[model samples]
Target: MGRTDELFFEMIETYQRHAQTARNAKYQETHEMAEILLNMDITAMWCLTQRTPDTRSRLI
Candidate 1:
């Protein structure tokens, strides 16, 4: 194979690997959230929020 073809294949492989990593992370997050809800006995609602770098306020 030519150098250009090799580079193209390498780029595709890298992209697929990165995509799989993202997919796995998302799956893990979902599984953890489900486990938390299942193990909780309270009727309280669960919310996920991210803290901003500049403020104490949380973004849901």
Candidate 2:
């Protein structure tokens, strides 16, 4: 994997961790917002990977 790929995965992990933290803290609104953001990030990542066959292969 390249540096960019590593950074992308790190970002996703961070968002997921933050969402769980918010949920654990009983911040329902924050948790929901975090979840939404996480989904958006994943969607964006998927779309970006789809733009290149090499990236799509690496992802799989």
Candidate 3:
């Protein structure tokens, strides 16, 4: 993989690890909510990129 891809995956892993660590903490309610939302948003964007466009994708 390219360096950029490796870096990207590393960042994702870091976020996931942080999420897990926060989940184990006592005062993590707000942090958990924010982390979950951030994860969801990033996942949604990645899924969107994987979709094959039915129209005018490459031309645009």
Candidate 4:
């Protein structure tokens, strides 16, 4: 898998592990984030938000 994919999965795993011991409110937020990541169309989302270097410079 690509580096980005590996990092994304690792982030999800971290959140899942945190959810196991996180307090109620923090647990809920982490759990939700993990679920969203699990279900999201990550590549499509990245494509939709990806900016060219020119556009990136304009936002600064």
Top candidate on TM-score is 2
Query: Which window of 10 residues has the lowest lDDT sum in candidate 3?
Result: 51-60
> Which pairs in model 3 have colliding backbones?
none
Model 2 C-alpha lDDT per residue in residues 1-60, reported as the tens digit of each score: 776677668777877786676577566787777778778777877776877677788768
Query: Which sections of candidate 4 miss by over 4 Å?
Result: 23-60
Which residue pairs collide, candidate 1?
none
Candidate number achieving the greatest lDDT relative to the actual structure: 2
- Each model's lDDT comes to 0.42, 0.73, 0.58, 0.50
Of models 1 and 2, which has the larger lDDT?
2
Please state the error at residue 54 of candidate 4 in Å.
18
Per-residue lDDT of model 1, residues 1-60, tens digit only: 545444445555655555555456557776565445443412221211122232213212
TM-score of each model, paired residue for residue: 0.41, 0.63, 0.44, 0.38
Candidate 4 backbone collisions, by pair = none
Q: lDDT, candidate 1, residue 22?
A: 49
Error of 3 at 1 (Å): 0.7
Q: What's the CA error at residue 50 for candidate 4, in Å?
A: 6.3
Ranking by TM-score: 2, 3, 1, 4
Ranking by lDDT: 2, 3, 4, 1
Task: Return the lDDT, model 2, position 10.
Answer: 77
